[model samples]
Target: MKIRTIVFLTLFTCGSLALLVGSWLQVIPFTLTEDLGFITGALSVWLTVVENIWNFPIGIANDIFFFVLFWQAGLFADMGLQVLYVLLGLQGWYLWLHGGKNKTSLRVSNISPLELLVLVLITGIATTSLTFYLQTLQDSAPFWDALTTVLSLVAQYMLNKKFVENWYGWILADLIYIPLYIYERLYLTGVVYVTFLVMCLFGIRAWLQSRRAYA
Candidate 1:
């Protein structure tokens, strides 16, 4: 890592820790777990935008925190999604290290049109089924929750495969998530999603540059 990158990560981590402490002390209106999740989630996304492999471990931590937080909030689909994220995070870690041609480091690539069509169909069907299941459980925001959950899974898969289109999926998911989290009264988490939305734009630009470099 470069010196500037180390300095930035250190500063960001410290600032996040301060927010977590403030939440714990009741100085902030957010829960401790939500704050922790926000910190790890934000860092993970930022690192991902920079194409860093370290995002996987940090994202796994975010997934654990969010699982507990979502469970308490009665977002069953999201809680389940976190579990899948941990598994995906592990796979993404390895792929980022050696999933390219000849087992080299992964490079950003575009998703094929057929793959895009298949993913869209899968997302639609999965969201419908999950929404129905959540409705049976009286889940709040069932349709939106199910939609974001499936979108997130698709985005994570694209990310693991180093597809540049992953940012589009994340951007769509985050747009829905910002309002959904606020409705659930997880204001801090909503804010985190807003941040994720912005970082995803940067991810798109950075990954495109990377792809051009590879070419």
Candidate 2:
């Protein structure tokens, strides 16, 4: 079969399956909108494998959907994180397209020591502050929410640069979030994050291969 035909078939099959599963589970109420996140995640996964810049666009869609879902669930930090994701997506698109010397675009690079240190410090502070504030606000499971919120932000920043380390952050965050989601009775989102965790492991391997090929 032609590659284009194969691609089309794969997308169609995946989308149909996601729709069927979501409907059967009643993950979305009264509409088929809930399946879009799966579709977007699939596209982003494909793009990430290809090291294509288009991942940012699909990432935007994924973030937006999750943002609304989190907001509805009263996960305010996660909800606000999506707003940041939108801005970061834009920044990443531009950086990948233009942030390099000689007017060339940037390429995947390993994390610098200084940057890594800064990220750790920032995440730590952010998590602490958010946890304290959320506890005051009577948020359910504030500590776990704050932890995942900070981890998610760091993971997202790594993704912007196509950093392999992003997957590590995702893996850790998803593991924590899965239990939190379960405790909060967000079964559907728990399932999605579990799926994301698996994908993130694959993503790390995939991006490392891409980085080697690019180098």
lDDT against the true structure, each candidate: 0.94, 0.78
The segments of candidate 1 whose C-alpha lies over 4 angstroms from its true place after superposition are: 1-7
lDDT by residue (tens digit), candidate 2, 62-146: 8888787777678887778789888988988887788767757776668888999999999899999999999887777788889
Candidate with top lDDT is 1
Please give the distance, in angstroms, between residue 23's alpha carbon in candidate 1 and its true position after superposition: 1.6
lDDT of 2 at 181: 76
Please state every model's RMSD to the true fold in angstroms: 1.4, 3.1
- Model 2 scores a TM of 0.84
lDDT by residue (98-192, candidate 1, tens digit) is 99989999999999999999999999999999999999999988999999999999999999999999999999999999989998999999999
Q: Which number leads on TM-score? A: 1
Which residue pairs show collisions in model 1?
none
**In model 2, which regions exceed 4 Å deviation?**
1-33
